[model samples]
Target: MLKVLFAGTPDVAVPSLRTLAADTGHFEVVAVLTRPDAPTGRGRKLMPSPVKQAALELGIPVIESDPSEESFVSCLKATGAEAAAVVAYGKILKEHVLDALPLGWYNLHFSLLPDWRGAAPVQRAIWAGDSVTGATVFRITKGMDCGPILAQSTVTIGAHETAGELLERLADDGSHLLAASLEAMAEGRIVPVEQPQGAFEVARKITVEDAHLRFDVPVFAVNRQARACTPNPGAWCELHADGDANGEPTTLHVLAARPIADDDRDNFATMLANRAGNGDADGTSASSLNPGELLVTKRKVWVGTVTDPLELEQVKPQGKKAMKAADWARGARLAPTAYVK
Candidate 1:
């Protein structure tokens, strides 16, 4: 059996640790390396990373020291680990730390090699409208996720899947891929192949500003933006009373949304015009809903985009709990011309 050291931090990394620990016949997880406890929650109490918690449950030794510390290399050498497996460890491994193990470290990245290489592959893939994305297990080199690939597995992105939902699936599926690659490495059955050379996209970490929704963009673009940021720096927009430029804008978090079909858009527009008694005799007009304009009915809420409107399914207003979009509109008692910016 190959003795392995595991390095990881988030909940996404837990599955691979569990898989390797359970496969006692082929692998023995000697120890786990993870980030130290950090402040979390509203109360700001320090809490251990998910990987550290899992390691404790599995009765494995854990090293939470920074890799840059001089003693970190010594601590790693003491674990008697032959190689290391990493998943979202959230730290750079310098040459000295890499040299501590006999076999080089392998990292499980949540994207195909040479694509979406960076800190936020999953979110970037969704934001870029990638129809398919996958995981790659590669030997860790000095460059960021630029190592040779040992194995890869692809999965289709759902039409309306949010980054959080897609990431959850990838984490579960990629755990098996990581384990298989390590098993092949142990048996000397696999060779790492260099990634293809070419221009590729980098998935930089998403920031709070990146999650702000732009209603001026096309409906599909708006939909993608909202999905890409869901459940994390969540998609948001500024809500102000119509023509209330001097009023303080409320931040509205869009939890779920979808593009309105052409027919549905027309129907909604006509309904709004009829409610306001502003349409022609046939309740039809050549005018389109201006971007950011809102049309809220008893059962639904739609916001205009460049091309069409996006239906808001769930939303949270500033300092308010999440609720159905229609419910929020009703409670706020917004004007007929209310819109978001």
Candidate 2:
């Protein structure tokens, strides 16, 4: 068995830590490294990371500080760990610590490297509408996610899968891959392969502006944005027309949506304008409604876009509980062709 240092943060890192810890015959986890505890939740109480909590339960020593802490590197040097493994550890390892591990450090990234190679890879892949994405175990380098690949396992992205759901699956898959790679390394059968430079695309960290829903794009694009930003920063848009009783436009966050199919592109706009009164003297002008318009009927709620209309199934209004899209539309008393903005 080989002694190895394990470093990671968040719930996503817990499985990898637990796996390496439990497989005592193959590898001994000498010490666990994680970020310091910070305030969490509405009560704002200090809380240990999921990795720290798991390490304590499993009887492992936890180092909850950075590598630059006074004498921390010296203490780590005494662990006699031959190698290290990091998963979503939230910090880059310094050169001294990297050099300390004789067998080198391994990172289990959520995306197939040389493609999405930075923070939030899985979310960015889904956001870009990539049909396939997977896990990659690579040698840790000074550059961000720019490392030699050791092992990889690919999985298809579901059509409408949200980032939260896809991340859970990838975390489990990556854990197994990391454990197996460590086993191979212990047996001296693993060889790292250099990632192709030309195939690189960065996955930049998501921001508040990235979560703002844009109605000018295709319906599928809008749907992907909602899924990519769901349960995190959250994809939202402001209402431009319909106001509350106090005459203020409400901000709405889209939680779930589906694109409506229209076979006749030529007649689609005309048909929609007819179905919903087209905001004219006779209520039938095709030019009355514009893209981003909100069309409300008794049973369904559809929002216009550049391509086809999108049916909003679920939405969360500011300062209120999440409700069905139809319910929200019914209460808005929408004009013949009210723009959602």
Off by over 4 Å in 1: 261-263, 279-287
Tens-place lDDT per residue, model 2, 1-341, is: 98989999889899899888888889899999999999999899999999999999999898876887767778788888888999989887777878878888999999988889998898899989999999999989888888898899999999879888898899888899999998897798998899886766799888888998888888788889888987677888877554333356678888888776545333445556556556323543323335678766665677777876777889988887899988987886676646666
After aligning candidate 2 to the native by TM-score, how far in Å is the CA of 111 from where it should be? 1.1
Whole-model lDDT per candidate? 0.90, 0.82
- Winner by lDDT: 1
The regions of model 2 sitting more than 4 angstroms off are: 241-248, 261-289, 331-338
Candidate 1 RMSD computed on C-alpha atoms after optimal superposition onto the true structure: 1.7
Which ten contiguous residues of candidate 2 have the minimum total lDDT? 279-288
Query: How well does candidate 1 score on lDDT at residue 71?
Result: 89
Model 1 Cα lDDT, one tens digit per residue, 44-77: 9999999999999999999999999988888899
| lDDT of prediction 2 | 0.82
